[model samples]
Target: MSRFTSICLGFILMMVSCDERDSNPTFSHDIAKIIYHNCSPCHRPNQIGHFNLLTYTDVKTNANKILYTVKNRLMPPWPADPHYTSFVGEKVLTEKEVGLIETWVKQSCPVGDSSQIPALPTFPIGSMLGTPDLHIPVKPIRLQGNYTDRFLVIKVPFEVPRDSFVSMVEFVPGNTKVVHHVNGDLVRFEFDKKKDVYDGSLVDNLVWDSTIRLVYKKIGLLHDDGSYPTLARSVVNYLPGVIAQKYPEGIGGWKVNRKSAFVLADIHYGPTVDDVWDSSYINIFYAKSIPKRPLQEFQLGTLGVSSIVPPLIIAPDKISTYHSSCTITNDISILTINPHMHLLGKSFWAYALTPEHDTIRLIKIPHWDFNWQNFYTFKKMLKIPAGSTIYIEGVFDNTRDNPYNPNNPPKEVHDNNGSMRTTDEMFQFIITYLPYEEGDENISLE
Candidate 1:
């Protein structure tokens, strides 16, 4: 074809595509599937989402709000940039999907066919994986109506039939609206060392004046002779939009004694206007066999193996950048990673540099959301050779322009010696990995 003819033909095709895309989009036919896949996971009942988006009516009422959030790239809350690296179970929506939601809302959200709408997905109740072998209930805690954040340490003790293997432990928040996050540890007590595992206080408020050793004493985490029991760190954790981490069989499991207790080192709960009671519990899944490999963890920045450069002290009305680095002494295969920060966090990025000067991207969050921090799992195992150094860079905004800043007039904010309070600041990168094995990079972690 001639040049003019080809140009005219291309213009015509482009116009046709635009018309087809902008045509009358309906909720039942065009939008329901997207909402169900991306929004329903947390927007349904008993989840972190403030409202439900299950049925057609439920979505129609919030159509404008949904359109705004998707258009702004705010709602489905995947902080990691997909352009840098990809992860499993990412909830990011495509450009075309966002456009469809916008077009549907602009067209007044018509229900194309009531009978053609797809049925809502069945979300497993209480447990996301399956039925648990045992359920250990945490003692109920009461919160006053005062609008202030509270942090507490609790112990949930249980005795099983005999010594067994635990494949996983899942935390279920009783009050999803107020519960922020939990960092739990497993305490194993010898059957003969302690006669009763459930004899002491189940919960205690965390105060600035109290030391960790004092809190442990108050909660009875010691044995009869006053020696500490075996403790496993980061065994159970929970965040607003995070699913519990699980691996393939024989990958990561723990051997539990007949008498054991789960120690929630720090359980954070957000502010509430009315008094409430929270009765969260832990679900234990028994393993069929002993684990062949156990996960190892290390951290960088606040209270980690590495310290933050220039310290994590931000001044008033300023944006600052800080970094932390750690050198790997042994070859390892990585499974999951979690980047942590408090309210002032603006963005985060982490990567590894090899001795040969090659770079491997780990994760990069262009925009950080304090509410939706997840323990990101890779699709397959990642291998980091020895002599490689991992680096992390985090940016914090402590100005009035930052809506999440806690202070009215941003003051000098410091890490406050690795405090866990929401008002204070912290920066940490926790990595879970195992010693390297042959063909580890080829194993799927999904």
Candidate 2:
């Protein structure tokens, strides 16, 4: 071979190898992909996360924070015990994914060839499912810029022209920073006679220190009485990092009675906010046709506690723990479970015990955060037999050491004389399931 040709070939090989390295672990190719997929959903603006991780600049600026959260198993907060059942939409990074971020940060975030950067995934604007068929909302709530947590309960009337099959429901917040969480319920009732009150009579009856806990009951349950035809079932609910509620494919949507009046569940937005106005609303999606199996949702704690009564009262400067359960009368396919506690929650666990004494691990959150709670859905439906019992237990801390106590000097927390509040505490599991059929277990709830 001629000397010139040999030199050219050698140069070409080195360039090819270097190109491979560029795509190997560079920020544009590797770290960006991981962040966009796992962290971007919550980390982006207009979402719950504090900072944005959309672009290389945003990510590089916050690379150290990201590295710490991922290494400590904090960001992309999913608390379910993976050993039990693999879940859908779980953003928890795998060991490899976590290490990739750590390496990118340790090496100083390098922006490789920007051309290889992938396009951002387009998330739906109005509704995650699609444009909602009906929008039922109360007047937008305005904040006075006090930076105090506020709860508003209003019953807005909606006329359903005919029977509707709801495929999905979503709570889209107007201002996420001011709107911490929202609980939406659907019931067959008329609200024309009810008058909407600001800081209603319920909030008036509470004793607390300068920042002591207030017993704010019925934050959304307008009539304290479970007055609707049936228990107020939640069709739309929101936590900091949770998304829309859509049932599994082929599994039917919950049916709303024909010509019925609906109530909008109240919202929780108090401390850690601005004067921004929030007009959160509920978006209901319709199914193309009725589903084969209808979805059913029920609470398994406080209201539905069957096995043993859990504690609702929290003493001053004390840590409390309790357990609650519900017996499965018939075979059922479990789709999703939501563990709910107010600011004082410490940890949570949920599992099932079959009649044969076999245990089916459902979901467990070792550390509970009121700001980051979400619905945990199984990758595939889990079927529990007719003779099984689902149980949930949670630990509560009202001591001053607990950072989220919400009060300066932790006061005695009780059921507002009889009701519950965000400042007060309660233990329960919200289970979304459908009656099990012969082959229901094979269906996916994703």
Q: Give the alpha carbon lDDT tens digit for every residue of 1-446 in model 2.
A: 99999999999999998666643567877888888888887777787677888998999999888899888888778766566567877767888778777777778887889988888887656666667888866557677787666665444445566766777877777777778776655654333422332323322312342111122233332333434233246666777666775776557566665433334434677565456777767777887888777768788665564533545777788888878887878999888888877788899888899999999998778788887677787877889999898888888899998998988899877544324356766577888888887786777767
Best by TM-score: 1
Clashing residue pairs in candidate 2, if any? Answer: 148-270, 149-270, 149-271, 150-269, 150-270
For candidate 1, the per-residue lDDT at 73 reads 85
Winner by lDDT: 1
For all candidates in order, the CA lDDT equals: 0.88, 0.70
Per-candidate clash tally: 0, 5
| Residue 349 accuracy (lDDT) in model 1 | 98
- Candidate 2 ranges beyond 4 A from true positions: 1-24, 190-232, 257-264, 270-273, 307-310, 415-418
TM-score of 1: 0.91
Task: Give model 2's TM-score versus the native structure.
Answer: 0.82
